[model samples]
Target: MYLLLVFRAMRNFIVVGHKATTTPSFSLEDIPGTSGRLDILCRAVTAAFVISHGIRKDVCVYLVLLGGEIPKTIRLVGETLRHLNPDERTTAALLKKALAVPATPEWAMSTSGIFVRTGGLAEVLTDLKDAKLIYLREDGADIRGLDAPGKDSSLSGEAAFILGDHTGMTPEEEALIEQAGARVVSLGATSLHADHCIVLINWFLDTNVFMSG
Candidate 1:
């Protein structure tokens, strides 16, 4: 009966194609007044950067500030077009590049610049997804092919359990995950790290589902 109960529990948790409604598009008016005033250009840039960085929820709050600063930056650039020093212009360019990098879950965990514990990554993703602040695509392609073919395909039952990471999974477990609809992408053969999870998060963000608000 114990084994049967376990089987039943597993069966109940299986993922299937349930029609989830499409997320609405983001609009500037949707932002709360408390978020502060921002120009359209900055809002667009901040949204793009946040989505690219794996949909890190911690950084989303900063978008409110970025929205306001964009116009100021543009005004500064226009005012100093002729008088701007080469060094200052270069510094501004570098700052723009720095803002382009998306904040990741790992980066959020590094409070003191140290590596975050492995267990924390899954929790962060789950919380973000639950809050509706971040949308999660189960298992998908890299950023380049996010819009291409076979992107929204659902993962198989076995694959969902394996990637769920209830406890430490093994090589055999990983094989089962692939069989269920997941693609096991590794940075290196020796590295057991799960990088594809981040890829899926980025894909969701790229779709701009969460940015609507």
Candidate 2:
């Protein structure tokens, strides 16, 4: 969530489901606990709450667990974040509670936010597009040394960036990105983890450190 807070303009995150199994589009409403992938799901939930303020404002996270016993997509809306202690333990407990919520589109209240939908990256981007938000893919050409030439200027205003997990985006995921026409931008030539990329993006945006040769 620190990433979300740092880049305040970035309000959405979508985890594509490549290996996960279920229907093509499934809501995370009522699947049995044993049906969904809880490990990574829990981690995503923790990350969502960690960055959210006690009083909701921005930030929304989506998880698409398609390879599990049942395909489920989860959403944690930042607006509903309340009474959540910003600690590892509390986040874990909240995750447990979310996992048990009945599979329904209705928002499931957690100590932090509400989990209420299973949406693919394409679907989510469509929503953002309808809202007129700029979308960028956080990969492809490096933007490290191009700050002075207007590359950084392209990032101005409210926008959303697409980032993959540790394993990176699969070929199928890339295809969907192409369909969305998201401009590809990079931080550096060296491959950095997704988390590091977020920090660097924020640092560069908030200060001129990245512009120095």
Candidate 3:
């Protein structure tokens, strides 16, 4: 009976994306509480990978950037895989893909009162850092921290504001725009005329594609 239970668990692990080459070997003695050592072995192996895979890539990048041997990163990734939740392990894979492409370009938009003017240099690029869309470099310029393929200048004015500021919108404002399927842009320096601001805000808030599943 114990052997049969162990076999069943092993089959389940194989079905759930375990690669045969890297699977760990387990002996009955390795597991203390189990009546069936084989079953415990299977559980240990599956649990280890499911929890660690998501964090593996990030940890690898960190270690490599620090000038350490690359092999160490691989071992660390393997180690981290032992502790992450299974869902997080799966999501990490998806996050890696999502981060592969640049989300949008960064450009400056002008705001007057409630009105936003797309195009032209941003009156205040510094404010974008506060919104988390861009990070301030040592030189005091805001830059996209993610390794996006194209030149930073390729970003459009509207895209910059949208990426920079939408996350900070008020719940009411966000809800209304979300309900209307509108795109939101960063609210920067206020315009002189409220009507123009309204038009710009409305336009900016209505243009993004939702990608999260």
lDDT of each: 0.25, 0.51, 0.23
Highest lDDT scorer: 2
Candidate 2, residues 65-87, lDDT tens digits: the string is 55645445556676766555654
Q: Ten consecutive residues with minimal summed lDDT in candidate 1? A: 8-17
lDDT tens digits, residue span 1-213, model 3: 355331101000001111111111222343222211222223322333332334212111000001111111011133223333444233232222222322223321111101111111122232222221221112322222222335343222222122111122235433433443322322343322222332332232223112000
Better of 1 and 2 by TM-score: 2
- Using TM-score as the measure, which candidate wins? 2
- TM-scores, each model vs. reference: 0.21, 0.62, 0.14
Models, CA RMSD each: 20.1, 7.7, 24.0
Candidate 3's C-alpha runs over 4 A off are 1-143, 150-168, 176-213
lDDT for 203 in candidate 1 is: 43
The stretch of ten residues in a row with the least summed lDDT in candidate 3 is 8-17
lDDT of 1 by residue, 112-190 (tens): 1111111222333332332312112233333233223333422211112112221234455344444443443322233
What candidate 1 gets wrong by more than 4 Å, as runs, is 1-143, 149-169, 185-213
